[model samples]
Target: MKNISWIGIYPALLTPFTENDEIDYPLFQINLDAQIEAGVDGIIIGGSLGEASTITAEEKREFLKYCVKTLEGKKTPVIINVAEQSTKVAIAMALEAEELGADGIMLLPPLKYKADDDEVVTYFKAVAAATKLPILIYNNPVDYGIRVTLAMFEELLPYANVQAVKESTRDLANITNMLNKFGDRFKILGGVDTISLESLMLGSHGLVAGLVDAFPRETVAMYKLVKAKRYDEAVAIYRWFMPLLELDIHPKLVQYIKLAATAEGIGSEHVRAPRLPLKGAERERVLKIINDAIANRVALPDYKNL
Candidate 1:
């Protein structure tokens, strides 16, 4: 099995698009380079933050190939997300991701339909059985409406490839619950940016961060500080980051984050149809938050050196 350490920061990266609404390879590469330089432990592509619903399968494949080729031998593993509505399509995509050099998979419950516990477990098991690559189950019941409760994860214990989970249930207790019930059987990564420090402080292995797409250095520095037991310093940065981090939870997060990244000179705010760019007051409000954070951006310690 290809080894992908499910620890430290993993950005659920944004898919940069051109003015023509096509994948902007140049801009995407710029953002990917930013994430790499910030020292993210891993990268997740085609996630909800990546606007997976709007992205075509062919586009996803091309993006994955581009990322794989770009990240070649950099020691940064790229994990492709599988959020299909069909068992067959999910399995096929998982297999193709493996074939195309993805280091791992971030599997979500079937999209559009809320599968009951048994059905959801079955979906996960089927995909796990089909792929030898390591899997990080994307467990965001709050958004996806299909919660992978502890009982359901018990059903997945037999699959060695189902190695970790993106714990986005928005319930902090779930972190300790996973630690208490499963021990180290599954690596738990905090999936929400707002509660990331709390999650890490509670023993989550790492984070699948959202705002990190634009503020990668701050995200990485905060994680390193937390791990190094520098609580005060980490809290200082998290406090400054909270306002901008709040952008990840909103419905227009793609636009909000894309705009933030654009402000940081890494990306553009062009999203696919049905999700237009922020306009009027909404744009100003989000820009104010981003600008305030930038103006008050904390001088990070030598977290990388530490």
Candidate 2:
């Protein structure tokens, strides 16, 4: 397996859906094009931002296939998020992604039930063993209630395919410790949008951001500034984007982001069951926030609206 670098801005793309809650393949294509135009380094599909938890295993496979086919012969690498409740299911998805020509596989800790560090390590090793593709470990303790300790990541580093990690724990010390120890080996990607700039400044290779699903241009611009070593300019952009990033922690984040995308005319705000659309005053409030943010230059689109 080739080494996959998780550098620069990679949006955890939201799944586009029609009003009937069916996958809108055309809209999905448009969104992908928009992201590429905005200059993202890579694309992450079927992640938390993509509502993977609500999607079936078959849907996941189809989505990965579609993405690989769509981006075929392109420079952008596609990373498929294959985090299922069952390790077997996750491994199956990983193998399917590899077979479909995906560049890498990203996995989250088992969310249905919390497991100890040893179990988590074993789970990742099993998934990694299933395919020769590069693997990215997604560590989001807040959402999964499970933490992959620094030691755990250290243990998994021996696996040649385990090349990167998405650290969403929001603990600076943990990030510092990881960078201090394994900086040369594993590429660290900041999973939380809120801390993306800070994480980059602190030596994180890139961001796997959900907010970038809505504000790709600004997010990518900030990363570019940092890449140029212009800390002052990057901080200004980061501060401007703080409010939009704050929306990622919202319980209705998927709805909020989709609504924001709709406001920009990129896609619909339609989400799956157990994740209903924003309703009543709450809907209006979020819509206004998204619109106002766009007006104020927080979430500007790269393309001209029709």
Candidate 3:
């Protein structure tokens, strides 16, 4: 039992927007309040779920500042994603997040070019040197084209700030291998919703779930059950929520999530340019699935304008 104690449910929150595509600070506060009511242990701001790439740097800073202000007196921690294309940018963002009173920072590997092990280690070391707060390494190979191998992690773990890793790779064998090797040194969090239960069983500390944006209560219940050593109950809830989680893997994930949230009155389905809302049969299908889930009393958030 090392000091790595990140467990339970953490929502990879969506960046709420107005119909005009501006960041809705009010709606964002509403969403955060809802997550707190649902009992989530923490919230992830400006990750993939937050549409970080579409958000400008200034908006990112504002969002972190607001989250810090809003969550100041609460027990729920806020982890700000400091991912950028360059190491210097990442370092700058991490320092800014730390200054904003963020509890921790999550980072992605440098996205421009594929770096060797030494380069990757150096990148993280530089980021670690910039912040005294905890750092969660986000290993999203699909998006960044860089895979952080275990050897690379071994080299980077010497930096005292690198405390956690969000393993988003699709390879379960690699996940199991990492759990076997460095489970003590790092708090491993599951990034994929479908494999979350498996990840927990395999020694992951918890999940930073995208689906939790829609079904926070159910996700929180699942986490509590798993943490209580109640796998059978946890698997039952997972199976029930499997359809909703499957929707996240679609290419139109941002669109689908926004559509689902809109249907549930949590937020609008307004994605930024280069990503549009779900329309035609795709939109209809998503609506039907979410509607049916609600009709079946699947522990949904309050849905309006059905």
Candidate 4:
């Protein structure tokens, strides 16, 4: 119900699974605290990076409760992803998230089914009407195959709770178009992990970053530097970060990111089934990339301390 500002590096926190593929609540709590402690602006509880598709409804609700409880009295607002297949299910999740005391919800137009534009628009509006929680419109057509265009935004015009958008269109022009067309009506959070610097350089409001899961402080440091108008410094950090950030857009992003996060000591290299752990040549290659970064990790300058 409250207006939660959607900006800055929302890590899209990875869900830690146990050795037997159960939800590891304790490890999830540790990862959440590390991200909040590292100074991210907001926390998106269950997102694509969080492996929301594989996570059960009960797990989602429990995670939302965990976020609300752990981040109690904090400025960092916790938002959960509601990417259900049915409108009814999505609306139910939205209402439940609000009831469970989440700061906001991110809606990714009915997952799995390639719904038509009008159908997608209607689904988003219905969920918006079902709850008072502030909503972030996740427009990642690249992965979801339903790009929420400006026309869709026009249809969402009636909903005051449609406060922000996760722009993963992977096109810088879309950012300009959204800004020029809507003129700040919707806050824009860069969704693609690889192009975060480009997004901020072109004036995006902030980022819903994937790389932040592994390198929380480094991600936050880049955000702080960019916002402070230190473009050169920000670019330097981005240059060093791009190799790992690009992992977020890959096919095995779940496995890759979990490995990276584990390397940082915040989570386990565990993923729910249907998705498996990286192995053999694929495993060795990914580990080398992650290990190299770990060895020469950026000494993020004072952003956390200051």
Estimate the lDDT of model 3. Answer: 0.80
Higher-scoring candidate on lDDT, 1 or 3: 1
Model 4, global lDDT:
0.87
Top model by TM-score, which number?
A: 1
Which scores higher on TM-score, 2 or 4?
A: 4
Q: How does each model score on TM-score?
A: 0.99, 0.94, 0.92, 0.96
Q: After superposition, how far is residue 89 of candidate 1 from its true place, in Å?
A: 0.9
lDDT scores of the candidates, listed in order = 0.94, 0.82, 0.80, 0.87
Put the candidates in lDDT order, highest first: 1, 4, 2, 3
Cα lDDT tens digits for candidate 3, 1-306: 112256777888999888888899887776677778878878899987799879998898888888888887778888888877788888888888877788888888887788877888899999898788788898878767788889989987678778888888867776778878886788888888888888888778888888778777778777777777777777877888887888777777777777767666677787888788778998898888888776775443322111
Model 3 worst lDDT window (10 residues): 297-306
- Highest lDDT: give the candidate number: 1
Ranking by TM-score: 1, 4, 2, 3
Worst 10 residues of 4 by lDDT: 297-306
Candidate 4 lDDT over 212-235, as tens digits, reads: 888888899999888888778788
Q: Higher TM-score: candidate 3 or 4?
A: 4
Report how far residue 285 has shifted in candidate 1, in Å: 0.9
Q: Model 2 over residues 1-306: C-alpha lDDT tens digits?
A: 855667777789999888887888999888888899988888988887788878877787788888888888887889988777788887887787888889998888876878899989999989988899988888888888998888898789779899888988998677778889987588888888788888998888888888777777788878877877877777887888787788888777888889878887787878999888889999988877777777788443332221
Hey, what RMSD does candidate 1 come out at?
0.7
